[model samples]
Target: MSMDPKILAFDVFGTVVDWHGSIAAEAKRLSLPVDPNEFAAAWRNGYKPAMAKVRSGTLPWTKIDDLHRMILDDILKTFNITSLSESQIHELNLVWHRLNPWLDTVEGLTKLKSKFTIVTLSNGNLGLLADMAKNAGLPWDLILSAEVFRHYKPDPETYLGVAEIFNVLPEQVMLVAAHKDDLLSANACGLQTAFIERPLEFGPNFSRQDLHREEFTTYHAKDLMDLAAQLNCK
Candidate 1:
């Protein structure tokens, strides 16, 4: 153990849980006419651009729940899904709050929790992350979000804020995420970075070819369990 980092902040969504899988499953269960995979992809595709509007001040700061609803509305329109009632659509929008964790999530997080403080550093709003953690039985020491910092991932404020919240140096906090962009931002903020690969994050059909060895990451692992083993968390 390095004994340098007292805190390990995680990125949720694809990092902690399988968002695409969960959404697709929910869509399938709802008997949507469209392919579940395509629906999931279409919904997620709207996320970044939606967040970009907030990041660039093109739109006012918005919570992820609202952004997700916005995207869901767009996808429903695109798919010509008008059969479902408004209440059903609203419930569908909350599927993100009940996403399933990766198979190794609980065990790996439990192992790491024994060694260091584990918290969420996701762009998700507080309610979404809290509901997901509770629903998935994720063992988190704390739940921090863009809602807490009023800033999203890839933003220096969000990364450095973790250290600030814990009264530690930037290097004393490590960011564990599946996205290179997220890890890169934390690296720029002087935090240690770990890349946890979620190759199937997008879905089985969509392969993420961008999972390359990167100089920015302090550690690279296949999943949360691999990360725990590499860190000697046990």
Candidate 2:
């Protein structure tokens, strides 16, 4: 396991921020007809497929904000709710930019930032991530995204792009994420991997089954704070 990675690239959704809880709360606040939890899940479920279209060349290179809007439109129809105006729909879509951070996120990232060059490696667009970091007080040296690379996670270009941006070898960078698929892809690209567990990432109704430590990852942490501790961060 490489303990001395030069750059720590983090996945924002479900790792630094509580996407499920945040989305559900916002949905409840908006008085949407569907169950808030289910709405959040449904919205998120559309993410991969929408991105797949871009990845497969079926769609042009679309930013996450645009993709999210497309998904939200479909979800609205599926939920059979017609109360929202266009402005309201746009504001609701911005919930992703206003997501709440996990309780330990700020403290953990602060600690790690003191020790390493910390940045984001999320599928979230640059503007979205910037707004989230501003809203949540996340301390980051940089906010790198799929938007910058024009490719999403699990794509080697996205992972290797971090290394290229920092002029470091892939092994000198570590991918810290809550998803195994992301870590696996980064590992395949010769980047070190750290898995952060977020069991409630899908909300209270669904428990994640893949939180176990795996051989592919150099570190397995319960949260960002745990990851900070493991890395001997102050």
Please report the candidate that would top TM-score against the real structure: 2
Task: Give the per-residue lDDT digits (tens) of candidate 2, residues 27-114.
Answer: 8999888899999999999999999999999999999999999999999999998999999999999999999999999999999999
Error of 2 at 57 (Å): 0.6
Question: Candidate 2 — which residues are off by over 4 angstroms?
Answer: none
Clashes of 1: 0
Alpha carbon lDDT at 184, candidate 2: 94
- Candidate 1's displacement at residue 162, Å, is 0.6
lDDT of 2 at 98: 97
Write down the lDDT of every candidate, Cα atoms only: 0.92, 0.94
Where's the lowest-lDDT run of ten residues in candidate 1?
1-10
Q: Which tens-of-lDDT digit does each residue in 1-234 have in candidate 1?
A: 344578999999999999999999999999999999999999999999999999999989999999999999988999999889999999999999999999999999999998999999999999999999999999999999988999877789999999999999999999999999889889999999999988899999998997887998898999888988888887
True-structure RMSD for candidate 2: 0.7
The candidate maximizing lDDT is 2
